[model samples]
Target chain A: MSDTTIKPRIEKAPVLERITTALPIALVPVLAVLGFVAIGDPAAWLTLTVAGLAMGLMIFIMASGLTVVFGLMDVINFGHGAFISVGAFVGFSILIWLGGWTASSSVFLNLAAVFLAILVSMVATGLMGYAFERVIVMPVYGQHLKQILVTMGGLIVAQQLIHVFWGPDEIHVARPESLRGSIVIGEAAIEKYRLVAVGIGVALFLAMRHVLKSTKIGLLVRAGVENGEMVEALGYRIRRLFLIVFMVGSALAGLGGVMWGLYQETITAHMGSEIMVLVFIVVIIGGLGSVEGCFIGALLVGLLSNYTAFLAPKVALVSTIALMVIILMWRPQGLYPVVKAK
Target chain B: MKEPLLTLSGVHTHIGPYHILQGVDLVVPKGGVSVLLGRNGAGKTTTLRTIMGLWQASEGTILFEGQDITKLPTPEISRAGIAFVPEDMGIFTDLTVAENMTLAAARGPLDPDRLEWIKTLFPPIRTFWESSAGTLSGGQKQMLSVARAIIEPRKLILIDEPTKGLAPAIIKAMSDALLELKETDTTILLVEQNFSMASAVGDTVSVMDDGHIVHAGEMAELAGDARMQERLMGLSLEAHQ
Candidate 1:
């Protein structure tokens, strides 16, 4: 063999590709400016902007798992909402049990109560996710139609189960005392809980990006997303990887459920189902399996919804759908399509 | 011959409703290149896939070093020291070339000496280490695919059509790479449509018609006899020339 180094021909990506890559992130600020202009009130814009960011973060938390699961496993788990509801109810139950801590004026105690709720909900939902994969997801791996039908069926069953345990009526949830009030900043007032949600969402996004970029497991996952059979052929148990991703994704949805439950100060069996519409919108807008795309899409939906709800309350419901339509028109495959061996 | 490194006796594979491989019996000797030649839809890829356990052999047995591997899952078959380079090259387009190689190494960090040796075999693997596998041209992707298979030492490798769709120059380079690879201790079961490329590196040859091996013999013997090649393949190697 010749000791010659064959340098790869380097070609910069064309202008179109660069623009598409940056479009999702760029849309955030552009939408914010559009909101600022349309609302015509700086204070309202600040409040809505923070509210949208916080809402987007929560949606990102819930939708992140679905996008990954869809990307890697090709499983459309409609029952993912069930995990959210389960987590919310489980977390709320803990808070109810720890009423003393939740009611305490001390920030530490209140935070502790909320933290315990989140931890317990995550564990419960994580285990539920494991069972969900084995029982509901494993058998319907390649059949998309069956996956949708069965997982939807699973969602209905889960809701019924939640109704059995938590009852049919909605339960009132109070944010922990320390997280209840708004923090006035300059002329803008932001809810303390929303700020916390934003922080958690940012942390989760960074952590997910880091893991996918640097870790061995992350490498397998990204590879598996592109070609799962190749990942198996390379001697890694891709099924095991999928199972782990499913469980973690379910846990994240559960965590989001807890946050959202407190944000609304209410919990119900139907809450997860109701949120599923928005979650689906985010996943679709983000591209089916791209996590970064999901985050951006979530923010877009969140801001658009908040802005529309404030500006034209009647159009709020259809605003996300309109956004999805416009986005799909621009990139039919979603914002960040995962390039796989077709 | 020395004890066969891998053997398939009356192997039958069923993919979904299609019974692709009726019975494929093959013997790959311990350390030389064995080329499987066949026309399209003749089950050459299926044979490799079955050996790698990507497609389960519904009936019969696959023995790797005398150990039954017919029931093993794809990952277990790979872990048992068998590597497969599928027809599509199986490069993870979303991942960088380095990530692709790292995933294939599976055991631990890539060996520096082996990496250097591979760089000589396929320079693109080194030059484009940080580049996404998707950016590589078809020929470079094929090179990366083969590089990944040989990244770690293995008992045997099943490669499907390494020279397919490559430019004449790249095919020549690939032929040279395979010839160099033959010098190593690894046993290879290669599936190729290009007779010239097969004749160049193959130590042994097997011809498949419709999933069953119709003929098996020394490559030199097959290469020298055009009549036998025509009878088995319905086309002679001379036809390409």
Candidate 2:
């Protein structure tokens, strides 16, 4: 026998028992296509599929940070949507103030404005998360009902604050020159702004994955998620960990808000409240705390909403809710749970 | 013979409004398994919890290696060369055996020599090296907990109950492993209800009753004193043996 043949069957059949294992993260795009096909007009299925995928990518980006905080810290932040709205408004203000929605402003200045807007949103929302953790969440650790009540109060306060500053009227955002118009791929015509948003979302997703795997803080997070008391016992200040996670989560939401503003070109005080319903559906369907699950969940919801809207228009609104119920019925813990080691 | 590594004086702990440890006093010399003996709900577990800094000693001082550590957080206390193995073993059930070991090691490389030593001490851990700790038998989980503590350069190890629900044979093995660990100069504060296991591995014994250390002395002295054993532990010499 050859040396290879003499060896024992080292390739033991890979265990298929991880009921919660993430589907290949690469297949998010593929699943998005499948989603569109299931819900879109038969003639325009492919284009709608691509659009739905793009939409999913946006939702995945928005909810990624929220899910990380949820999974790792066990904190369900209701102010996540508020952060997104803040990012959109901040970005919109920068755009309108610079050039009155005209095409003459330096592209560099516009980019800088976007960055500044995102930065403002990030800092504001991050600080909000920090304070929220210190004042409301920390004292009532492991109390779900208290968390729900306090954070809902926070949401109402944040919405009122947004209205106080930006006013109740709907605000308009202009697409950058480079992101204006449409991209024709094969027989598909897609909005250039939506594509750019998808690109940004993909970049952010990659960066989050790298940080979670490579960074010391990330390891601490994984350990903390498994056992907070043990992590605390290992000399880490749990309070600091909680703060850092909250900030990162809020910042991610802020970035998502910027993307959402760029794509829709509209902002309002209720933008957060509007998208929050979708965000919760995404996170809940994905699984309570799994990033992979959130990504998968977001994309599934995004595509479900987009294609269903494209097909039935009015009836499409219930698509996300339906998918959520179906998912819960199948796997009550969420689609891709982080399986407890047993 | 040497200065005590840990000194607890008038340690009091209250969980919320109810006082758990009321004026407990004890001392553990530098290199021995000092067993804290008591019946269930007699504050034996609370005494360990208080020392490990899980519960703040409301009105007492804990000196570890000559530094007061009563006010420090549990993590800081653990980092100050003391490791705690709780009654539940506090094993991260989601982590694999290897991951659990790595988590426990915290900052250091898995010392191969130490791993080999512990593997020799508790062979089942080697056999179940990749298995999740939650799948292990109760005895095996206790071994993993002790193994996790020993993986670090732990100057002091506090094990709440190493043989709480183990069979007689596994308890014997645990006692033998702890005896070997004691030989390596690791100071262990063990809380146990199993008197035979405690007597076999303990260098000194402190009997706790109603949240206070009622009797404390060298294990040899306590073992030799039949009347003292009956009064403190409610066990006659034959029953204790």
Candidate 3:
């Protein structure tokens, strides 16, 4: 209370910190501008930007859960892709069963089919996640090497099971008539479904942020990420909190799976494994446990991939890796590293 | 003089290959401060941790209100009206002070009057309520750690090295705060290295050496007798001065 008392070393002004935080978000537009300059075509640029945004949002949905799980549990679950694939297949089955709803020209019926698919997929994947944690992840709490091996084995088994059930061949999925077309604005054309994906992605991000920042469970989770022992000492069951987080994370991956499957208009047993590469890239670029970092990292990868594919089709595959390297050189701990005591 | 609120009898703990706690017998009496003192690696920390069930006692019993609690989980131990502030202070640096305090009030929402009382005890908890705890000074974080333990009333509070690595001014402030806490009905089992701080707030004292209690008696008697302090702690109060 004394004025002469030494102040706890004054941290950088909050405004400066805010600006640094906002800097990554600014990169999206800056990259978009660079794309416009390189292509020298306004219409193509507009189309690619929307496509990139949609792609980024979907990747965010998938990577968000992985980062949270890693951040809090310190578990590297290599089999997360299993949930994605399972959700896609389960959701696809429901869609096929609701043929009447998908075939209907009415928007309400078409939306209803997609909603049901998302709901069923989330539930199925969430339950799968519970079993996965109890069976494969619980025993190897602090053993990183075993976690990687067991989870990878789990992925392989899940993929094979998909083949056994859905057959070895790729299955074609048709979009509902209501969602199949694009809306034209001047010279730029944007797909309606991609716009819808963008809406859903933003909604999910806001909801997650609100929950993590405002709720008691979110507080415990964030605290658990820093020190699980402390949370337990404070009389909360950190294990139960982690289990709930793992299930929710798996459910989100499922929702992302349904969205991505629809975007590709094709479902295959190996689709989740295939996307795992990109998801891991997003997770690494985002910083291990930070949701905001994951969101920005996803968008950056999305835009870079789209822009590179447009400008130089051959370099598209390595664009994300290249970007990650450059980013790492600039900030070794990823774009927004959570400051945790080592 | 008062009945022991908690009692640990012949507790032994094994952490991996190291038998850290050979046998720790401690008694925390009701409604006063009891200081646990010893040199580094004396198993002082292991004793507190065992009571909180962070490290399970391999042998012997821990009783609370004469009920066996030797095998309860850490959360269960805490829920049974005991709070532990670990040696590291255990402040979640990523979270705001308010969030850390909120999590510690495990029973429910913080009582408004209690929150106000805590704010007066530790001003930084209120002053930096919205700032992430990582930004706090070592002393402020220590205050927040103690504030968290008393966020709600508990039968016993276990605090380990609350003044470690803090400035002298801050240590005095912490000592004063603990002295104030001594006036309340809360029972504190404190682990301390600073003799001045220990003698300032301690009602009773237990000294450990190589994982066992070597001496136990009234704090006033030990503080007044230089020969006893030297024999038990290898250093007297005057030596620190």
- CAPRI rating of model 3: medium
At residue A249, candidate 3 shows an lDDT of 94
For model 2, the DockQ equals 0.26
lDDT of each: 0.92, 0.76, 0.90
Candidate 2 lDDT at A133 equals 76
Would you estimate the TM-scores of all the predictions? 0.98, 0.86, 0.97
**Residue A10 lDDT, candidate 3, scale 0-100:** 43
Highest DockQ among the candidates is held by which one? 1
In terms of TM-score, which candidate is strongest? 1
Looking at candidate 1 chain B, the ten consecutive residues that score lowest on lDDT are B232-241
Candidate 1 chain A lDDT trough over 10 residues, lowest sum: A1-10
- Which pairs clash in model 1? none
lDDT of 2 at A67: 77
Off by over 4 Å in 2: A1-43, A96-120, A338-342, B106-140, B167-170, B221-231, B234-241
Name the lDDT value of residue B238 in candidate 1: 83
- i-RMS for every candidate: 2.2, 10.1, 2.2
Off by over 4 Å in 3: A1-18, A339-342
Query: Across residues A63-111, which tens digit of lDDT does each residue of candidate 1 receive?
Result: 9999999999999899999999999999999999999998999999999
Q: TM-score (chain B) for model 3?
A: 0.98
| Per-candidate DockQ vs. reference | 0.66, 0.26, 0.64
Clashing pairs in 2: A233-B75
